[model samples]
Target chain A: MMADAKKIVQVLFEANNIPIPPNRAAIFEQFIKKPGSEAVIRALLANQTELMEKWKLENRIMDIAQQPVRILNATVGKPYETWFDFDQLKWKDIAAFEFTGLEDIGLTFDPKTSQLSGVPAQSGDYKLLFRYRLQEEPEDAPYHEKVIPIIINPDPKSLWKKLDSNQQDPYWKEDDVTAFEPLGDRSILVSSKRGRSHANVGSFREDDFAFKALPGGWNIVVVADGAGSAKISRKGSALACNTVVEYFLDQPAVEGMAVFDELLKQYKTDNSEIQKKINQHVYNNLGKAALHVHKKLIAFAAEVSVPVKDLNTTLIFTLFKKYETGYALLSFGVGDCPIALLNKDVSEVTLMNWIDVGEFGGGTRFITMPEIFHDQKFATRFGFKVVEDFSYLIMMSDGIYDAKFVVEANLPNIKKWKEFLADLGGKNEDGISVALSTANPDIVSQFSAWMDFWSPGNHDDRTLAIVF
Target chain B: MRRLPVYLLLDTSGSMTGEPIEAVKNGVQVMISSLRQNPQAIETAFISIISFDSTAKQLVPLTDLASFQMVDIKASGTTNLGEALHLVATSIDNEVAKTTADQKGDWKPLVFIMTDGIPTDDWQKGLEEFKKRKTAYTVACAAGSNADTNVLKQITDNVVSLDTADSQSIAKFFTWVTASIGVTSTRVEDAGKEVTGLSELPPPPAELNIVV
Candidate 1:
């Protein structure tokens, strides 16, 4: 350890900045023996601050400097303070800046007042800049003192609006389709309930296999993923997944494959309109949202408003259908998650050739690109499969990749996959958020983890689905 | 080696009651955030607060700025420059000087004294004490409107006179302070000297209009 430290420190130190003592080896040995010790033995030191500092630093409580603890003042509005006497403030106020990391620190400007200070466990230099936005281009601060940094984190969620019901599930509505006839009776029956718990991934299986009463020789299945970025990718994914399985299962046995073709045509037609709506939504709304936020930010800056940045996000999905001869399907993903069809026997997972229909990630909606309307169908790039018989199917939204699931094809053990999910639950919450939040903190291993080293890793949200 | 004792001797006199006080308050938070971001600054900087209104008051005793809570200062009285100055001197003489290896302290003490009004009380005694102490750290003065420039000049070679802190000048002043401190920190490590800059523009000819 001592030798390692000598090598590390010697390599990093600036030449001629400070002399590296010869006996530093001994000092490093002492350091490694008692890690985090700031003590420098006089015998192993070059001239710097007096040796006494070495002793003082050794006993210092924390390594970094700490800002003084301040008893910040809050704005006063004791309920019945003052009515605007021709608009004159009667109470004292301080702009309580929002501090991050510290729990329960709230910053409020009651009906227009300054911020109040709250208890912060950690302290250091904080910027205390407060700016006032004016109607006009209002002059810049005489100098650039405009950016006042507070020494401590001021809590921003002072008004943590009751987690709005607006915590919306405003994405593709993928509901289970339940229209299959009884295969077990071999004769006739009524409703059949899908036994969903048993599967590779706990999603609804194709009609019969999902049913317990099915004494069938074999069963069928389907898997799908939803794109989260494009305005309507989720809708397209759900529409495709739900419709494909339902159409086949509901059809009379003789008309099964024929019915599937009609459903596909209808899907293509509906998808075209949906795509148009989505394109318009992005072009109309996204630009406006950015403009609104940017204007607010600029005003905030001009008034020395808040020094906070805004956030934006993306999406992806897949869809497939099951049949007696094995599932026949058309799947299309606009942005990232690549798709593949593997043989159910676990023998071969084929990477189907598919066109790259959508532009890559960078919040764009294709306002205008000519000669590519009918020529550039969103579902132009697609993969289809027909097998003699199959056991399982899989689809995902790159989140599985975080666990090192290969995009084109890689069959991870079910148990290993479950463990990966558990690791995910341990690291983050469930739902689509696993998409954006999968960027791991491991710096060393991250570079090698991705196919695109330039991107470091897939930042777009992730979704993974498997069926059996 | 003791930690550098940084005394923020602010003027809370009546003249500095409104915008001035607010700006100072805002500036302090900015400076605190700045220091906290710097690995070396936070470890070495210990801040003491002394606000002078009717009489100089020690709102907060010697503590690291990281831990120092900013008091909502109200400026409603006379400027006790003399008392505040004396307090700073005594603080250095008794508290800072006594810091040692056993005590866990810093190097040369630093005082960032800012004021906007004339001194009505006797500051001569405090000046004498200041002169007597062996110079170790640094003393910087941010002069405000109506501040006695001569009085600030007496205490330190480094002085930044701020004209009326109208709405526009806040960012410029703070930026200068940040730049100066950053450069000063670098210089401290490189040249081993306290680097100080007057409130001026980038070069000599184009001075930033900080002073009236």
Candidate 2:
């Protein structure tokens, strides 16, 4: 057995091109004395081909454990809760898990359980390395390592407060339903309310509406619905509505006329052509106003150290010019808010521009979404109605429409909705249309309170602005 | 106001008689109590309980969560899963309002089914018919080893399995259900859309396995 061991050792040294040391014999002698050492040497020599095949199998098995760990990006100062459970990550065979590179990031990773939790202390990009090995492998076993990029963003909640302190007020209060100011005897009624469900949860109202009466009989009305999934959507909606109204009020009357002049040049010299030009002008101005609001929102987001998308919201506005012949209604909107123009007889109800929705139901384009400027369907398409016989112009967020107006085809039935509104705006004992026609000081309170009407399955912040 | 309708289809087969049945009853109560605390659920979610044994019965009609009361569920006879599906379909049709030219109707309904054993009656046809309706989300749970996962998969991709019908596992399952309801209710109210499918379901406990 000793001779066999010596011969095997000599062959191994020669095959590896290694010169034998003076202590080689002693090492061989020590190895031979160990139990099972001779048997191991014999087995290797007898089955070199089989041993090589087994080594290849082991390599393949190790490759199976080389999957990259996926960790979602985090936001600073928000509860950063994430789990890296072995079972959840499909690493059932993992025996040891180690995390590195999180020491300075204010995050915690449990090596024993692979649980990660922390509110990021700062906002920056970081790379965290995670290493894991198979259950049967030794502590010193080769581990598969994954480098995951972690991005922490500044929390928008604090930044939003810093940018606009007055926003803290409950603007959706039932008594404060009127716009910042009245629009003369035009009988403008504005209502905003936190949906019953949102109110129940103590969440702030996400819908906002504001109207500004421009010089020369131009009325600018804006409505914005903040993205619910966005943590600071309420702020986004408020900022959008206020910014657009302010932009229009600051602009000279010629810029508004330039919107019409640009369209007038494109048409033939005729009365219908004039009307068409007027409609085009209204559409262009509203679209431009929306674009201005988007740019301002992006700038505000940067000032507050937040992603522009965090202030995601839908913008719908109208620049109305009432003429002696009739009222020229120009409306522009991005997202799912509804705008309808009702004729004097109330028989013909026309939905200005239908709500824009993506392939997936809830995916609606917002002003903060850059794609809105590129998508012609949402950007260029504005609701421009040059009507001589219109009585009331109604605009509302999806919160009010989705309750009783949603249909299978996705398009809202305007005729049916008009009837529902007529019922809500019933006649008074004096035979006057008290809700729709009259200018009552309590109209804001009544409209805001009326939105609380119970309907099964619809609990969203409601906003409605009517120009009669 | 459009209320989110949530239906719970429970199994009361003979196999679920003793501790399993009692645990299920307690689990349901836990769910109701948890939902009541969630403002979103309280404002929008409407609860209904349907139990199936040898026959399927509507133990509670669609009622607001604030008024929802837990009833004693008694175990009996074979698992008539087919009847339960039919009852759910019929109940939604009869109770849920449809959007017409005049006004909007209720949002899509959410359904959850929990069972401990294989169905004794034909459930395939009923399940297919139920799928034809506009449903927001659907989840089916196999409560014990005897429950057929293959059959449950046909009803919904969101399927969970419980290794044993112990009190702890049952309680955990109900907790998960409550969390799911809270999430859906919030989405509906916030987004003004009928969001379907499971996006953020609470992870199942140790005794429970999510069926991929």
lDDT of 1 by residue, A354-441 (tens): 3232211222222121222234553343444445554434444333342344322233234434444344333333221122122334
What is the Cα-based lDDT of residue A132 in candidate 1? Answer: 31
Off by over 4 Å in 1: A1-468, B97-105, B135-145, B185-212
lDDT of 2: 0.73
Q: Write down the worst ten-residue block by lDDT for model 2 chain B.
A: B98-107
Expressed as tens digits, the lDDT of each residue in B1-212 for candidate 1 is 22556677888888876787788788776676675554344444567788887898887777763455666788788878888878877777766744332232234555667777788888887677777664443444444456777777777766566666543354455555554444443333222234334532232122233332
The Cα error of candidate 1 at residue A253, in Å, is 99
lDDT of 2 by residue, A225-277 (tens): 88877766777888899988777766563367446534534444366867665
What's the TM-score of each model vs. the native? 0.32, 0.61
Predicted model with the maximum TM-score: 2
Q: lDDT of all the models against the reference?
A: 0.42, 0.73
lDDT of candidate 2 at residue A397, scale 0 to 100: 84
Give model 2's docking category.
incorrect
Model 1, residue B54: distance off in Å is: 1.8
> Among these predicted structures, which one has the highest DockQ?
2
In model 2, state the lDDT of residue B25: 93
